[model samples]
Target: MKKLTTLRTKVFAAVMLTIATVAATAQTNGSGRLVKQDRDLPGFTEIEAGSAFSIKVSQGDDIKVTVETDDNYLDKIETVVKGDRLHIASMGMKNPSAMRVYIRMPELKTLDISGAARIETDGGITGTTLEIIASGASKVKLDLNVELLNSKVSGASKAEFNGNASVHRSEISGAANLNALNLKTLTTNARVSGAGKASIFARDEITADLSGAGALSYYDNGQLNKISKPGTLTFTPQNPGSGPSEEISASVEATDAGDSTIVKIGDIKVSVREGNPTKITIGGSELEVDDNGNVNFKRKKQTRFDGHWGGFELGVNGYVNKDRQFDMPEGYEFLDLRMEKSVNVKLNFYEQNFNLISNKFGLTTGLGFEWNNYRFDNNVVLLKDGNDLINDNFLYARNYNKSKLVVNYLNLPLLLEYQTNRFSKKNSFHIGAGLQTGLRIGSHTKLVYQDDGRKKKDKDPGDYHINPFKYDLMVRVGWGKLNLHANYSLNTLFKNNRGPELYPFTIGIALVSW
Candidate 1:
């Protein structure tokens, strides 16, 4: 009996020895000295593109993608196609530069995935909708239709979802350029670096609960629904006045960023949700008439816009948020392309510095002609305007300036419009800051002076003598039909101190042909 017990002990010792040997061999890396795949586990046994181990999954079955490529280089991956109900993303990787995937479920409606993996797709689930959720600091390209999509990141993450995007607890570093977006959902705790540019191609909604810092410039695609008040549902960038005594839980740390918020909708609704502390960022319009669908973006931010001097069509136009706003930022005036409500038009916010050096319309000098009809129907200048002089002068009739002239001019402008199409659908933007060249064919000017401070004079200053050969500077924006343009002639129109400068900036409609 002692001998049999001794035999069993030897057998157990032998098995233990074999297991230890196997463990040592498995920990070894790839190619020792040469570059090869990291063969860590059975599932990670092979690391070659096009070589996949897939399990046939039905509606109820779980669909998972597990990758373990530690420290090894994964270059130029084609794609991983997952046709299952549930998708899992578990990857042990370092620098995954370029990797794409196309996923779809033949049975399920929505796919719920968890884990860390960087994937770039056309922005679709089943290659049709843009309902793809990304975890970790992953990059994704979405151009398809997505009903409801959101990406959450726990740590530092960077992902680019070009189409409509909704993020939760993620750090979208740089390289997240949303070209023509319907809406951008920046709730939760997220940080954006630079002033991102978003051209709302349609009437969409923007919910910004920002607590960090970044710049955001929005180009409303359609008729713009401007908001008069600040958002209540959305949080401004957080202010960590002083260091917290204890580590307080926050979705985002404002210390790591510069913040901004931009919301584009038809009018606005700034109301507190019932029985909820969170303020809801909702558009004035409904997403659907029958049922609640995904957020919808209609084109209504811009409308019947034509260059007053150039007669160019109005489209999506604004600064990249990189320039300085001496007077005002770009997109100050919302063009109601939707043309739904009573529209109000004005000059767009512009940085004239760039236009000064540009040869397209800035700096350049040329000659042109235009016929303008200044209609003072909608009191846009009186509606909360930042320019104090503009509000007072718009109300002051040029004929009241005690001059022999009235407010009227046939702008024969010959100004070189040096502009550029930096990045967008339009070719180039006409620099509205160029020194203009023009010949004034019509008449009318109001001359006001402090000499008559005691008694204000109201008389036609120049009804007969028109400002001829009115050559100065001119700058215009927009293309085709909609435009917000202005021109300031370098040479003064009046010969004496009685008349004002050729600074007649008319915010009206000018339809440009070609």
Candidate 2:
């Protein structure tokens, strides 16, 4: 019996020794390393990253991926390129010790993030749409230039946007927080049963629908547009000199009558009867009453522009001939070009300084850069001909597929603007007309074609007979950031008879106003 027990003990010691040796070898072979990958994926439209990892993204012409992780989990990190989208995800990591990924790609159309991850970026993100869904204890921080943003948080997650954005729409139901800075338009629908909060700073209008016990705070330069909440909602407008201001004041007085409470503030009144609900009325509109007995006060909508006179404006335009004139240089004719497809895109960075003559009248002047893209209808190439630019039809034998002209200018604009209700508490109406002069800084033409299933491009830079100086009549009319703009150039696109005798004009919607 003693010998058999000793034999079992020896067998157990051998098994344990083998296991320790294998584990040590595995650890040595699976140690972490720094990995870098780069990809040139043009025409990729979107980005989707998920899993338990920290990701940092930037903007570039191509996609660059860098990872630092243990070799044991190196095989678990995967990057998949499917169709027009690139996805990076981490798998097989139940509880990862350390992992970091950095991605750099071109401007995307959409960015989607999910899982228990920390995603961060300092600018360099420009898209039309952004979506984030966090189900774990995740966090996201970004400075984005997006027209629309949509986010949803279901766990103890947090999301923050610290740059200028046009619109933001969000929904939160967990112990999450969504904070935005320099946000223009915000619309939130939150049902927070936990300790959640949503806050926005330096915004224009906030439309919110709140329930549960969460809190929503909005700090705007203007008044709140609308609020429908069953809980607490607070809005504090910036002071006069800090931003756009509306003169608003209110005094509340409470009276007790027959076991009831009656409060009066300005022209608004509220009655809270015992064993009944609270009632409120402002002018002729009755405020919606909630079961929580919470009272909300909102000013009438005001006509104010957030970040006015000192921000950036990005927009695209449709360039078309105002009057049909089929006159071109001899031996050159316009090709089959779709009028709707001929597009011009512009980006302006300016600072507006205002000189107020009265409450309703003002003069505004600003300096900015105007980057213009004049895409041709078809593959028409431009050639220099003695201080003139004319279409070269002989270059079509190479079967050029795409061609466009790009121009950049330093511009200065002066305008006289009129605003109704500028001193009133109600919304304002605005109209501005001005003259703008531009100095040509750069001009070029590009042609693109396909060669052996691969795309090739050529750029030609010159005066191209383009005018060295240009001026235009510009007008803007709208209430807020959303305004209609028109600019008619008084000069032709090229020198006199240097090219087609076509006057250039642009009609488009301005996302920001002066």
Candidate 3:
């Protein structure tokens, strides 16, 4: 048994290592100058700027950016710190994103930047190297491209490419959403995330290789040519609906375009790339994937079956750190202080594979019913004293509670999952992630307080139902079937509510696994 566990660990490690190697080889870095990075987070790292926007590279360096209050600016760096080996992540969460650093990077070898970086490379793609390394947090975005050197991305990496991308060979995390049209080379790796499509082209000498977990999808609309490397390809095709077609457009390739890339697909996979596809015309609706799109397995509504013995879960989790700059509402003549609260939760069908996704880390995906939500409420004291109560927003405004923030949703989500020790019995673990299309199941508010606080009338915040589709991240750590867990709602707490963006997170013990 111990040997089996060790083997599982080894296999899992090997899989992740392969992915990292693939992403790393596909990234880009140039010149040998260290430009400052502008961290967009309120508590993230900053970037340095350059005068002429020259290219600079660095190997092995670490930087930390703390985005604090009252200060958000950008600057450029002219030099790269020599001999630094760690990467300080640049979070891209704010607007007017800019930061300047004082550093130098001359004759550097490699450059690495991770975390949420709103990166804009002014210089052209030259002798630059790019890669995704080990990370604990999950990231997801669209419309950015990292030069692929070797990629071992475990978090969500997404972007759209209008230009051609050049890559050697790299692995992609199931969370990576890449859509590029101009054909080029994509050396094989593991899973590709999302429902987005791109025109894939490999040099005739290059082959489309795939390994590791998740479903495989290969489809196109051209001369479905013969695969050169037949032995390297694998597949077992099964289409539930009118999803996967029989052919893909052939790209003009060199003689060694290897064999027809084989596709080894699991359940829940679809592939459609570029141009209106030829298909049977039925019911006046063209039965084909076009700019209108097809090869998509989108259920108008996918709910649970009765007697499935599955219900849903509700959660509330979030943090209320002390607001350094407390901006009271307009014309508030009185105010008070108290600890804040953040509420977040994931209520999914209990007895279903969806429950198998315990968002304890990174991202995850599944199909089931869910009513997940989160929010934040200030720990408010109506006034520091009765003297300040007259002008306070909490005290004077009769419609203040009406401004209370609430965000709830009913949704169908596409998720990506990254686990740490999923294959081990002694220390196996899983994290749940995925998007949710929460149809407003129900919403209610409570006025919670301890007797140590002052007395007030028992007023319910009333009920509200808003349509919100949300993405969630949850991390759980445990052995076997039981784990300690917390879920954080990644969406704003209120869409139409009249308050600040409130995020809710919930924590609880769960019996979950991959």
Model 3: per-residue Cα lDDT at residue 289:
53
Off by over 4 Å in 2: 1-332, 335-338, 423-427, 512-514
Model 3 TM = 0.30
lDDT of 1 by residue, 327-425 (tens): 222232221111111122221111112233322323322223343322221222212223211223356433332222222333333333434442221
Better of 1 and 3 by lDDT: 3
Candidate 2, pairs of clashing residues: 32-70, 303-427
Question: Least accurate stretch of 10 residues (summed lDDT) in model 3?
Answer: 302-311
Best by lDDT: 2
Error of 3 at 376 (Å): 18
lDDT, candidate 2, 305-373, per-residue tens = 222232234333323232523233344444223334344443343344454655567776655567666
When sorted by TM-score, best at the front, the candidate numbers are: 2, 3, 1
Arrange candidates, best lDDT first: 2, 3, 1
Quantify all predictions' global Cα lDDT against the true fold. 0.31, 0.61, 0.33
**Clash count (model 1, backbone only):** 79
Model 1 residue 210 CA deviation in Å: 2.9
lDDT of 3 at 513: 24
Superior by TM-score: candidate 1 or candidate 2: 2
